[model samples]
Target: MGVHYVEGDLTPEAAAKVERLGYTAVWIAGTREPRLTIVERVLAATGALAVATGIVNIWYAEAQAVADTYHRLEAAYPGRFLLGIGAGHRELGTDFRSPYQALVDYLDVLDESGVPKQRRVLAALGPRVLKLAAERSAGAHPFLVTPEYTRRARELVGPDALLAVRLEVVHCGVEAASPNRAPARRH
Candidate 1:
Protein backbone atom coordinates (compact mmCIF):
# COMPACT_ATOMS: atom_id res chain seq x y z
CA MET A 1 0.00 0.00 0.00
CA GLY A 2 1.15 3.57 -0.73
CA VAL A 3 -0.08 7.10 -0.26
CA HIS A 4 -0.66 8.80 -3.62
CA TYR A 5 -0.84 12.53 -4.17
CA VAL A 6 -0.81 15.06 -7.00
CA GLU A 7 2.19 17.22 -6.36
CA GLY A 8 2.77 19.45 -9.38
CA ASP A 9 6.22 17.99 -10.07
CA LEU A 10 8.74 15.94 -8.17
CA THR A 11 12.48 16.36 -8.62
CA PRO A 12 14.78 13.39 -9.03
CA GLU A 13 16.48 14.16 -5.72
CA ALA A 14 13.14 14.16 -3.90
CA ALA A 15 12.18 10.91 -5.59
CA ALA A 16 15.44 9.35 -4.45
CA LYS A 17 14.75 10.48 -0.91
CA VAL A 18 11.34 8.84 -1.07
CA GLU A 19 13.01 5.54 -1.92
CA ARG A 20 15.65 5.91 0.78
CA LEU A 21 12.92 6.61 3.34
CA GLY A 22 11.75 3.02 2.88
CA TYR A 23 8.63 3.43 0.79
CA THR A 24 8.31 0.35 -1.40
CA ALA A 25 6.76 2.38 -4.18
CA VAL A 26 6.03 5.98 -5.13
CA TRP A 27 2.63 6.52 -6.74
CA ILE A 28 1.64 9.56 -8.73
CA ALA A 29 -1.89 10.64 -9.65
CA GLY A 30 -2.26 11.28 -13.36
CA THR A 31 -4.03 14.30 -14.78
CA ARG A 32 -3.99 15.55 -18.39
CA GLU A 33 -0.28 16.26 -18.41
CA PRO A 34 2.48 13.98 -19.73
CA ARG A 35 2.64 11.61 -16.76
CA LEU A 36 5.32 9.51 -18.42
CA THR A 37 7.74 12.36 -17.89
CA ILE A 38 7.18 12.11 -14.17
CA VAL A 39 7.69 8.37 -14.25
CA GLU A 40 10.93 8.79 -16.11
CA ARG A 41 12.21 11.39 -13.67
CA VAL A 42 11.38 9.28 -10.64
CA LEU A 43 12.85 6.15 -12.16
CA ALA A 44 16.05 7.99 -12.98
CA ALA A 45 16.27 9.10 -9.35
CA THR A 46 15.83 5.79 -7.57
CA GLY A 47 17.73 2.57 -8.01
CA ALA A 48 14.99 0.24 -6.80
CA LEU A 49 11.78 2.12 -5.88
CA ALA A 50 8.78 1.22 -8.00
CA VAL A 51 6.80 3.93 -9.72
CA ALA A 52 3.07 3.25 -10.24
CA THR A 53 0.33 5.32 -11.76
CA GLY A 54 -2.47 5.49 -9.19
CA ILE A 55 -4.98 5.62 -12.01
CA VAL A 56 -4.12 6.64 -15.56
CA ASN A 57 -7.59 7.57 -16.81
CA ILE A 58 -8.03 5.95 -20.21
CA TRP A 59 -10.22 8.84 -21.35
CA TYR A 60 -7.48 11.39 -20.70
CA ALA A 61 -4.39 9.86 -22.34
CA GLU A 62 -3.91 8.23 -25.69
CA ALA A 63 -3.24 4.52 -25.47
CA GLN A 64 -0.26 4.76 -27.81
CA ALA A 65 1.36 7.35 -25.61
CA VAL A 66 0.76 5.19 -22.57
CA ALA A 67 2.22 2.19 -24.33
CA ASP A 68 5.27 4.12 -25.42
CA THR A 69 5.88 5.20 -21.85
CA TYR A 70 5.44 1.65 -20.59
CA HIS A 71 8.12 0.37 -22.95
CA ARG A 72 10.46 3.28 -22.34
CA LEU A 73 10.23 2.90 -18.59
CA GLU A 74 10.59 -0.86 -18.71
CA ALA A 75 13.63 -0.57 -20.89
CA ALA A 76 15.21 2.06 -18.67
CA TYR A 77 14.12 0.82 -15.25
CA PRO A 78 13.02 -2.73 -15.83
CA GLY A 79 10.52 -3.89 -13.17
CA ARG A 80 10.47 -0.55 -11.38
CA PHE A 81 7.65 1.18 -13.20
CA LEU A 82 4.14 -0.30 -13.30
CA LEU A 83 1.39 1.20 -15.43
CA GLY A 84 -2.01 1.35 -13.71
CA ILE A 85 -4.76 2.44 -16.05
CA GLY A 86 -8.53 2.75 -15.57
CA ALA A 87 -11.78 3.59 -17.28
CA GLY A 88 -12.56 6.95 -15.75
CA HIS A 89 -15.80 8.08 -14.12
CA ARG A 90 -18.83 7.92 -16.43
CA GLU A 91 -20.12 11.51 -16.16
CA LEU A 92 -16.91 13.03 -17.57
CA GLY A 93 -17.59 13.02 -21.30
CA THR A 94 -19.67 11.91 -24.30
CA ASP A 95 -17.05 9.19 -24.51
CA PHE A 96 -18.41 8.20 -21.15
CA ARG A 97 -18.65 4.59 -22.21
CA SER A 98 -19.23 1.28 -20.51
CA PRO A 99 -16.33 0.47 -18.23
CA TYR A 100 -15.69 -2.90 -19.78
CA GLN A 101 -15.71 -1.66 -23.37
CA ALA A 102 -13.61 1.37 -22.57
CA LEU A 103 -11.04 -0.80 -20.85
CA VAL A 104 -10.99 -3.26 -23.69
CA ASP A 105 -10.48 -0.52 -26.25
CA TYR A 106 -7.75 1.09 -24.19
CA LEU A 107 -6.02 -2.28 -23.92
CA ASP A 108 -6.38 -2.83 -27.62
CA VAL A 109 -4.51 0.37 -28.21
CA LEU A 110 -1.86 -0.67 -25.72
CA ASP A 111 -1.51 -4.00 -27.44
CA GLU A 112 -1.22 -2.33 -30.81
CA SER A 113 1.51 -0.14 -29.40
CA GLY A 114 3.39 -3.24 -28.17
CA VAL A 115 3.04 -2.92 -24.42
CA PRO A 116 2.94 -6.39 -22.91
CA LYS A 117 0.04 -7.51 -20.71
CA GLN A 118 2.48 -8.65 -18.02
CA ARG A 119 3.78 -5.13 -17.40
CA ARG A 120 0.56 -3.21 -16.84
CA VAL A 121 -2.29 -3.36 -14.31
CA LEU A 122 -5.90 -2.25 -14.30
CA ALA A 123 -7.62 -0.12 -11.71
CA ALA A 124 -10.36 -2.69 -11.16
CA LEU A 125 -12.81 -3.37 -8.35
CA GLY A 126 -16.06 -4.93 -9.50
CA PRO A 127 -16.24 -8.53 -10.72
CA ARG A 128 -16.36 -7.91 -14.47
CA VAL A 129 -13.38 -5.56 -14.41
CA LEU A 130 -11.45 -7.96 -12.20
CA LYS A 131 -11.98 -10.75 -14.70
CA LEU A 132 -10.73 -8.44 -17.45
CA ALA A 133 -7.67 -7.71 -15.37
CA ALA A 134 -7.02 -11.43 -15.13
CA GLU A 135 -7.37 -11.94 -18.84
CA ARG A 136 -5.79 -8.74 -20.15
CA SER A 137 -3.24 -7.26 -17.78
CA ALA A 138 -0.93 -8.07 -14.91
CA GLY A 139 -3.64 -7.68 -12.24
CA ALA A 140 -5.81 -5.33 -10.21
CA HIS A 141 -4.65 -2.34 -8.27
CA PRO A 142 -7.80 -1.51 -6.33
CA PHE A 143 -7.93 1.72 -4.40
CA LEU A 144 -9.75 2.67 -1.19
CA VAL A 145 -11.29 -0.78 -0.78
CA THR A 146 -11.91 -2.94 2.27
CA PRO A 147 -10.60 -6.30 3.47
CA GLU A 148 -13.87 -7.87 2.46
CA TYR A 149 -13.42 -6.42 -0.99
CA THR A 150 -9.96 -7.98 -1.23
CA ARG A 151 -11.29 -11.35 -0.15
CA ARG A 152 -14.07 -11.26 -2.71
CA ALA A 153 -11.85 -9.73 -5.41
CA ARG A 154 -9.42 -12.57 -4.95
CA GLU A 155 -12.18 -15.06 -5.63
CA LEU A 156 -13.50 -13.12 -8.64
CA VAL A 157 -10.04 -12.54 -10.17
CA GLY A 158 -8.71 -15.99 -9.33
CA PRO A 159 -5.37 -16.70 -7.60
CA ASP A 160 -3.14 -15.79 -10.55
CA ALA A 161 -3.98 -12.09 -10.80
CA LEU A 162 -2.11 -9.81 -8.47
CA LEU A 163 -4.21 -7.87 -5.94
CA ALA A 164 -2.54 -4.67 -4.76
CA VAL A 165 -5.11 -3.07 -2.49
CA ARG A 166 -4.80 0.20 -0.61
CA LEU A 167 -5.37 0.22 3.14
CA GLU A 168 -5.10 3.11 5.60
CA VAL A 169 -3.24 2.66 8.85
CA VAL A 170 -4.40 4.44 11.99
CA HIS A 171 -2.19 4.37 15.04
CA CYS A 172 -4.08 6.35 17.66
CA GLY A 173 -7.48 7.74 18.69
CA VAL A 174 -6.65 11.17 17.26
CA GLU A 175 -5.59 9.64 13.98
CA ALA A 176 -8.71 7.53 13.79
CA ALA A 177 -10.90 10.56 14.45
CA SER A 178 -9.90 12.37 11.27
CA PRO A 179 -11.70 12.01 7.93
CA ASN A 180 -11.21 8.24 8.24
CA ARG A 181 -14.98 8.01 8.23
CA ALA A 182 -15.06 9.33 4.68
CA PRO A 183 -12.88 6.49 3.30
CA ALA A 184 -14.84 3.95 5.31
CA ARG A 185 -18.07 5.36 3.89
CA ARG A 186 -16.90 4.66 0.32
CA HIS A 187 -16.49 0.98 1.09
Candidate 2:
Protein backbone atom coordinates (compact mmCIF):
# COMPACT_ATOMS: atom_id res chain seq x y z
CA MET A 1 0.00 0.00 0.00
CA GLY A 2 1.10 3.63 -0.57
CA VAL A 3 -0.08 7.18 -0.71
CA HIS A 4 -3.44 7.29 -2.53
CA TYR A 5 -2.84 10.26 -4.76
CA VAL A 6 0.57 10.97 -6.20
CA GLU A 7 0.29 14.08 -8.32
CA GLY A 8 1.30 12.94 -11.80
CA ASP A 9 3.06 16.18 -12.63
CA LEU A 10 5.23 16.26 -9.51
CA THR A 11 8.82 17.26 -10.12
CA PRO A 12 11.38 14.50 -9.75
CA GLU A 13 12.63 16.02 -6.50
CA ALA A 14 9.19 16.28 -4.95
CA ALA A 15 8.27 12.75 -6.04
CA ALA A 16 11.44 11.63 -4.30
CA LYS A 17 10.27 13.44 -1.18
CA VAL A 18 7.01 11.48 -1.41
CA GLU A 19 9.04 8.29 -1.58
CA ARG A 20 11.04 9.37 1.46
CA LEU A 21 7.79 9.80 3.39
CA GLY A 22 7.53 5.99 3.83
CA TYR A 23 5.05 5.33 1.03
CA THR A 24 5.83 1.98 -0.50
CA ALA A 25 4.20 3.06 -3.80
CA VAL A 26 2.83 6.12 -5.54
CA TRP A 27 -0.36 5.91 -7.62
CA ILE A 28 -0.79 8.45 -10.36
CA ALA A 29 -4.09 8.63 -12.20
CA GLY A 30 -3.03 8.23 -15.80
CA THR A 31 -6.41 8.60 -17.50
CA ARG A 32 -6.24 12.37 -17.38
CA GLU A 33 -2.55 12.48 -18.18
CA PRO A 34 -0.13 10.13 -19.84
CA ARG A 35 1.90 8.65 -16.96
CA LEU A 36 4.80 6.72 -18.39
CA THR A 37 7.00 9.84 -18.30
CA ILE A 38 5.98 10.63 -14.75
CA VAL A 39 6.67 7.05 -13.71
CA GLU A 40 10.15 7.33 -15.16
CA ARG A 41 10.82 10.63 -13.43
CA VAL A 42 9.71 9.27 -10.07
CA LEU A 43 11.70 6.08 -10.52
CA ALA A 44 14.75 8.11 -11.46
CA ALA A 45 14.29 10.15 -8.29
CA THR A 46 13.69 7.29 -5.82
CA GLY A 47 15.39 3.95 -5.50
CA ALA A 48 12.69 1.96 -3.71
CA LEU A 49 9.21 3.32 -4.21
CA ALA A 50 7.03 1.53 -6.74
CA VAL A 51 5.24 3.67 -9.33
CA ALA A 52 1.77 2.66 -10.55
CA THR A 53 -0.51 4.22 -13.10
CA GLY A 54 -3.65 4.21 -10.95
CA ILE A 55 -5.74 3.58 -14.06
CA VAL A 56 -4.73 4.28 -17.61
CA ASN A 57 -7.88 4.64 -19.66
CA ILE A 58 -7.96 1.78 -22.13
CA TRP A 59 -9.83 3.76 -24.78
CA TYR A 60 -7.28 6.53 -24.86
CA ALA A 61 -3.93 4.76 -25.30
CA GLU A 62 -3.54 2.08 -27.92
CA ALA A 63 -2.14 -1.28 -26.85
CA GLN A 64 1.09 -0.86 -28.80
CA ALA A 65 1.73 2.51 -27.24
CA VAL A 66 1.00 1.16 -23.79
CA ALA A 67 3.19 -1.84 -24.32
CA ASP A 68 6.06 0.20 -25.69
CA THR A 69 6.02 2.56 -22.74
CA TYR A 70 5.60 -0.34 -20.32
CA HIS A 71 8.55 -2.22 -21.74
CA ARG A 72 10.68 0.90 -21.75
CA LEU A 73 9.89 1.62 -18.11
CA GLU A 74 10.41 -1.97 -17.02
CA ALA A 75 13.73 -2.14 -18.78
CA ALA A 76 14.83 1.06 -17.10
CA TYR A 77 13.32 0.50 -13.65
CA PRO A 78 12.85 -3.26 -13.34
CA GLY A 79 10.20 -4.21 -10.77
CA ARG A 80 9.57 -0.66 -9.66
CA PHE A 81 6.62 0.04 -11.95
CA LEU A 82 3.16 -1.51 -12.11
CA LEU A 83 0.70 -0.82 -14.90
CA GLY A 84 -2.91 -0.43 -13.77
CA ILE A 85 -5.42 -0.06 -16.53
CA GLY A 86 -9.22 0.18 -16.84
CA ALA A 87 -12.01 0.50 -19.36
CA GLY A 88 -13.02 3.86 -17.85
CA HIS A 89 -16.49 5.11 -16.94
CA ARG A 90 -19.52 4.80 -19.14
CA GLU A 91 -20.38 8.36 -18.25
CA LEU A 92 -17.47 9.49 -20.37
CA GLY A 93 -19.76 8.23 -23.17
CA THR A 94 -17.37 6.16 -25.16
CA ASP A 95 -19.31 4.17 -27.77
CA PHE A 96 -18.01 0.81 -26.66
CA ARG A 97 -20.82 -1.71 -26.20
CA SER A 98 -19.51 -3.79 -23.33
CA PRO A 99 -16.81 -2.63 -20.92
CA TYR A 100 -15.88 -6.15 -19.89
CA GLN A 101 -15.51 -7.23 -23.49
CA ALA A 102 -13.49 -4.12 -24.20
CA LEU A 103 -11.25 -4.93 -21.27
CA VAL A 104 -10.77 -8.44 -22.53
CA ASP A 105 -9.96 -7.06 -25.95
CA TYR A 106 -7.53 -4.59 -24.43
CA LEU A 107 -5.83 -7.36 -22.49
CA ASP A 108 -5.60 -9.39 -25.66
CA VAL A 109 -3.96 -6.47 -27.37
CA LEU A 110 -1.63 -5.99 -24.44
CA ASP A 111 -0.66 -9.63 -24.54
CA GLU A 112 -0.11 -9.57 -28.26
CA SER A 113 2.00 -6.44 -27.84
CA GLY A 114 4.23 -8.30 -25.32
CA VAL A 115 3.03 -6.90 -22.02
CA PRO A 116 3.07 -9.71 -19.49
CA LYS A 117 0.02 -10.21 -17.28
CA GLN A 118 2.12 -10.31 -14.13
CA ARG A 119 3.36 -6.82 -14.77
CA ARG A 120 -0.09 -5.30 -14.92
CA VAL A 121 -3.31 -4.96 -12.93
CA LEU A 122 -6.92 -4.07 -13.67
CA ALA A 123 -8.96 -1.28 -12.17
CA ALA A 124 -11.83 -3.46 -11.04
CA LEU A 125 -14.43 -3.38 -8.29
CA GLY A 126 -17.31 -5.80 -8.78
CA PRO A 127 -17.13 -9.55 -8.28
CA ARG A 128 -17.25 -10.64 -11.91
CA VAL A 129 -14.65 -8.10 -12.88
CA LEU A 130 -12.48 -9.02 -9.91
CA LYS A 131 -12.69 -12.64 -10.96
CA LEU A 132 -11.66 -11.64 -14.45
CA ALA A 133 -8.73 -9.65 -13.08
CA ALA A 134 -7.55 -12.62 -11.05
CA GLU A 135 -7.70 -14.86 -14.08
CA ARG A 136 -6.13 -12.42 -16.52
CA SER A 137 -4.00 -9.72 -14.91
CA ALA A 138 -1.82 -9.65 -11.81
CA GLY A 139 -4.57 -8.24 -9.61
CA ALA A 140 -7.11 -5.48 -9.08
CA HIS A 141 -6.70 -1.83 -8.16
CA PRO A 142 -9.88 -0.53 -6.51
CA PHE A 143 -10.59 3.17 -6.17
CA LEU A 144 -12.93 5.14 -3.88
CA VAL A 145 -13.35 2.10 -1.63
CA THR A 146 -13.74 1.35 2.04
CA PRO A 147 -11.85 -1.24 4.10
CA GLU A 148 -14.92 -3.46 4.09
CA TYR A 149 -15.03 -3.31 0.29
CA THR A 150 -11.33 -4.12 0.25
CA ARG A 151 -12.04 -7.22 2.28
CA ARG A 152 -14.87 -8.26 -0.02
CA ALA A 153 -12.80 -7.51 -3.08
CA ARG A 154 -10.04 -9.69 -1.73
CA GLU A 155 -12.53 -12.45 -1.22
CA LEU A 156 -13.86 -12.16 -4.75
CA VAL A 157 -10.40 -11.92 -6.24
CA GLY A 158 -9.38 -15.04 -4.32
CA PRO A 159 -6.14 -15.58 -2.43
CA ASP A 160 -3.57 -14.95 -5.13
CA ALA A 161 -4.83 -11.78 -6.76
CA LEU A 162 -3.17 -8.66 -5.41
CA LEU A 163 -5.74 -6.27 -3.95
CA ALA A 164 -4.48 -2.71 -4.05
CA VAL A 165 -6.85 -0.08 -2.75
CA ARG A 166 -6.49 3.56 -3.78
CA LEU A 167 -7.45 5.67 -0.80
CA GLU A 168 -7.82 9.45 -1.01
CA VAL A 169 -7.01 11.53 2.03
CA VAL A 170 -7.77 15.21 1.80
CA HIS A 171 -5.61 17.47 3.92
CA CYS A 172 -7.61 20.60 3.61
CA GLY A 173 -9.93 22.74 5.78
CA VAL A 174 -12.26 20.45 7.76
CA GLU A 175 -15.45 22.00 6.45
CA ALA A 176 -14.20 22.05 2.91
CA ALA A 177 -13.35 18.33 2.90
CA SER A 178 -15.98 16.69 5.08
CA PRO A 179 -18.47 16.63 2.24
CA ASN A 180 -16.04 14.81 0.04
CA ARG A 181 -16.54 11.52 1.82
CA ALA A 182 -17.68 8.92 -0.68
CA PRO A 183 -21.16 7.59 -0.19
CA ALA A 184 -21.50 3.86 0.31
CA ARG A 185 -21.43 2.12 -3.02
CA ARG A 186 -24.25 -0.32 -3.84
CA HIS A 187 -23.35 -3.56 -5.58
Candidate 3:
Protein backbone atom coordinates (compact mmCIF):
# COMPACT_ATOMS: atom_id res chain seq x y z
CA MET A 1 0.00 0.00 0.00
CA GLY A 2 1.00 3.59 -0.58
CA VAL A 3 1.16 6.32 2.04
CA HIS A 4 0.98 10.11 2.18
CA TYR A 5 2.87 12.91 3.93
CA VAL A 6 2.37 16.63 3.93
CA GLU A 7 5.02 18.61 2.16
CA GLY A 8 8.09 19.09 4.38
CA ASP A 9 6.77 16.62 6.93
CA LEU A 10 8.84 13.65 5.73
CA THR A 11 12.57 13.99 5.31
CA PRO A 12 14.42 12.32 2.46
CA GLU A 13 15.73 9.57 4.73
CA ALA A 14 12.26 8.86 6.06
CA ALA A 15 10.90 8.73 2.51
CA ALA A 16 13.62 6.30 1.61
CA LYS A 17 12.58 4.18 4.57
CA VAL A 18 8.96 4.27 3.39
CA GLU A 19 10.00 3.08 -0.03
CA ARG A 20 12.20 0.38 1.42
CA LEU A 21 9.32 -0.89 3.49
CA GLY A 22 7.32 -1.47 0.25
CA TYR A 23 5.02 1.52 -0.14
CA THR A 24 4.17 1.89 -3.81
CA ALA A 25 3.75 5.65 -4.10
CA VAL A 26 4.23 8.73 -1.94
CA TRP A 27 1.42 11.26 -2.29
CA ILE A 28 2.46 14.71 -1.10
CA ALA A 29 -0.43 16.72 0.35
CA GLY A 30 -0.89 20.47 0.90
CA THR A 31 -0.97 23.31 -1.55
CA ARG A 32 1.72 25.54 -3.00
CA GLU A 33 4.40 24.58 -0.51
CA PRO A 34 7.36 26.96 -0.32
CA ARG A 35 9.78 24.04 -0.11
CA LEU A 36 9.26 22.39 -3.49
CA THR A 37 12.90 21.34 -3.27
CA ILE A 38 11.99 18.79 -0.62
CA VAL A 39 10.14 16.81 -3.30
CA GLU A 40 13.31 16.67 -5.35
CA ARG A 41 15.21 15.39 -2.34
CA VAL A 42 12.69 12.62 -1.79
CA LEU A 43 12.79 11.73 -5.49
CA ALA A 44 16.58 11.49 -5.36
CA ALA A 45 16.42 9.14 -2.39
CA THR A 46 13.80 6.66 -3.62
CA GLY A 47 14.59 4.13 -6.34
CA ALA A 48 11.48 3.30 -8.33
CA LEU A 49 8.36 4.49 -6.52
CA ALA A 50 6.06 7.16 -7.95
CA VAL A 51 5.93 10.54 -6.17
CA ALA A 52 2.73 12.51 -6.75
CA THR A 53 1.55 15.87 -5.56
CA GLY A 54 -1.89 15.45 -3.99
CA ILE A 55 -2.49 18.90 -5.39
CA VAL A 56 -1.00 22.29 -6.16
CA ASN A 57 -3.62 24.97 -5.65
CA ILE A 58 -4.21 27.07 -8.77
CA TRP A 59 -5.60 30.02 -6.87
CA TYR A 60 -2.41 30.43 -4.86
CA ALA A 61 0.14 29.72 -7.60
CA GLU A 62 1.09 30.57 -11.17
CA ALA A 63 0.84 27.82 -13.77
CA GLN A 64 4.10 28.63 -15.54
CA ALA A 65 6.20 28.06 -12.46
CA VAL A 66 4.42 24.79 -11.84
CA ALA A 67 5.03 23.74 -15.43
CA ASP A 68 8.70 24.62 -15.11
CA THR A 69 9.02 22.44 -12.02
CA TYR A 70 7.21 19.59 -13.75
CA HIS A 71 9.60 19.78 -16.67
CA ARG A 72 12.67 19.91 -14.46
CA LEU A 73 11.54 16.94 -12.39
CA GLU A 74 10.59 14.95 -15.48
CA ALA A 75 13.99 15.63 -17.03
CA ALA A 76 15.76 14.43 -13.90
CA TYR A 77 13.58 11.48 -12.90
CA PRO A 78 11.54 10.57 -15.99
CA GLY A 79 8.18 9.08 -14.97
CA ARG A 80 8.67 9.37 -11.23
CA PHE A 81 6.74 12.63 -10.83
CA LEU A 82 3.06 13.40 -11.33
CA LEU A 83 1.61 16.91 -11.07
CA GLY A 84 -1.80 17.21 -9.47
CA ILE A 85 -3.71 20.49 -9.73
CA GLY A 86 -6.78 21.74 -7.90
CA ALA A 87 -8.98 24.73 -7.21
CA GLY A 88 -8.41 25.08 -3.49
CA HIS A 89 -10.70 26.43 -0.81
CA ARG A 90 -9.68 29.79 0.59
CA GLU A 91 -11.09 33.04 1.92
CA LEU A 92 -9.64 35.22 -0.85
CA GLY A 93 -12.58 37.57 -1.19
CA THR A 94 -12.16 38.65 -4.80
CA ASP A 95 -9.34 36.36 -5.95
CA PHE A 96 -11.15 33.05 -5.52
CA ARG A 97 -14.05 33.52 -7.89
CA SER A 98 -14.71 31.31 -10.95
CA PRO A 99 -12.61 28.37 -9.79
CA TYR A 100 -13.72 26.07 -12.62
CA GLN A 101 -12.76 28.59 -15.28
CA ALA A 102 -9.52 29.29 -13.45
CA LEU A 103 -8.64 25.64 -13.57
CA VAL A 104 -9.36 25.52 -17.31
CA ASP A 105 -7.20 28.57 -18.00
CA TYR A 106 -4.40 27.12 -15.88
CA LEU A 107 -4.50 23.93 -17.92
CA ASP A 108 -4.14 26.04 -21.03
CA VAL A 109 -0.86 27.39 -19.68
CA LEU A 110 0.39 23.89 -18.86
CA ASP A 111 -0.53 22.80 -22.37
CA GLU A 112 1.41 25.62 -24.04
CA SER A 113 4.33 24.89 -21.73
CA GLY A 114 4.25 21.26 -22.96
CA VAL A 115 3.49 19.48 -19.72
CA PRO A 116 1.81 16.39 -21.16
CA LYS A 117 -1.70 15.56 -20.01
CA GLN A 118 -0.68 12.07 -18.95
CA ARG A 119 1.79 13.47 -16.47
CA ARG A 120 -0.83 15.45 -14.58
CA VAL A 121 -3.96 14.84 -12.50
CA LEU A 122 -6.81 16.97 -11.16
CA ALA A 123 -8.42 17.30 -7.74
CA ALA A 124 -12.11 16.94 -8.49
CA LEU A 125 -15.06 16.65 -6.15
CA GLY A 126 -17.98 17.04 -8.51
CA PRO A 127 -19.12 15.58 -11.80
CA ARG A 128 -18.17 18.46 -14.09
CA VAL A 129 -14.61 18.80 -12.78
CA LEU A 130 -14.16 15.07 -12.78
CA LYS A 131 -15.25 14.98 -16.40
CA LEU A 132 -12.84 17.76 -17.22
CA ALA A 133 -10.04 15.84 -15.53
CA ALA A 134 -10.69 12.71 -17.51
CA GLU A 135 -10.98 14.47 -20.84
CA ARG A 136 -8.00 16.80 -20.48
CA SER A 137 -5.67 15.20 -17.96
CA ALA A 138 -4.60 11.82 -16.63
CA GLY A 139 -7.30 11.37 -13.98
CA ALA A 140 -8.85 12.55 -10.72
CA HIS A 141 -7.23 13.06 -7.34
CA PRO A 142 -9.90 13.38 -4.69
CA PHE A 143 -9.35 14.18 -1.03
CA LEU A 144 -11.13 12.83 2.06
CA VAL A 145 -13.73 10.86 0.12
CA THR A 146 -15.71 7.69 0.74
CA PRO A 147 -15.75 4.44 -1.26
CA GLU A 148 -19.02 5.55 -2.83
CA TYR A 149 -17.40 8.75 -3.99
CA THR A 150 -14.61 6.72 -5.52
CA ARG A 151 -17.17 4.66 -7.35
CA ARG A 152 -18.85 7.78 -8.66
CA ALA A 153 -15.54 9.38 -9.63
CA ARG A 154 -14.54 6.30 -11.58
CA GLU A 155 -17.83 6.37 -13.40
CA LEU A 156 -17.44 10.05 -14.15
CA VAL A 157 -13.82 9.82 -15.28
CA GLY A 158 -14.28 6.58 -17.18
CA PRO A 159 -12.24 3.39 -16.76
CA ASP A 160 -9.01 4.67 -18.33
CA ALA A 161 -8.29 7.63 -16.06
CA LEU A 162 -6.21 7.49 -12.90
CA LEU A 163 -7.52 8.11 -9.38
CA ALA A 164 -5.32 9.16 -6.47
CA VAL A 165 -6.95 9.85 -3.12
CA ARG A 166 -5.48 11.88 -0.28
CA LEU A 167 -5.75 9.91 2.92
CA GLU A 168 -4.81 11.58 6.20
CA VAL A 169 -4.32 9.31 9.15
CA VAL A 170 -4.50 10.68 12.67
CA HIS A 171 -2.82 8.73 15.42
CA CYS A 172 -3.81 9.23 19.05
CA GLY A 173 -1.55 7.51 21.52
CA VAL A 174 -4.23 7.20 24.25
CA GLU A 175 -5.88 3.81 24.39
CA ALA A 176 -9.62 3.80 23.72
CA ALA A 177 -10.42 1.85 26.89
CA SER A 178 -8.24 4.02 29.13
CA PRO A 179 -9.85 6.36 31.63
CA ASN A 180 -7.54 9.08 30.42
CA ARG A 181 -9.20 9.03 27.03
CA ALA A 182 -11.79 11.63 26.33
CA PRO A 183 -15.38 10.45 26.30
CA ALA A 184 -17.07 10.22 22.95
CA ARG A 185 -19.62 12.95 22.30
CA ARG A 186 -22.78 12.08 20.45
CA HIS A 187 -25.22 14.32 18.70
Candidate 3 residues 30-131, lDDT tens each?
758523576789899999878888888887668998898888899999999988889987556367558889999999999999999999999999999999
C-alpha lDDT of residue 121 in model 2: 96
What is candidate 2's TM-score against the reference?
Answer: 0.82
Tens-place lDDT digits, model 2, residues 1-187 = 5765545466678778887787788787754444467778789999999988888887776667888889899888899888998987656655656888888988898889888889899999888789989999999999888888988998898888888887545554657546444442222
Distance from true location, Cα of 104 in model 1, Å: 0.3
**Considering lDDT, where higher is better, how would the candidates rank from best to worst?**
3, 2, 1
lDDT of each: 0.79, 0.80, 0.84
Q: Give model 1's TM-score versus the native structure.
A: 0.83
Q: Top lDDT: which candidate number?
A: 3
The top-ranked prediction according to TM-score is: 3
> Sorted by TM-score, highest first, which candidate order results?
3, 1, 2
Q: Report lDDT (Cα) of residue 2, candidate 3.
A: 70
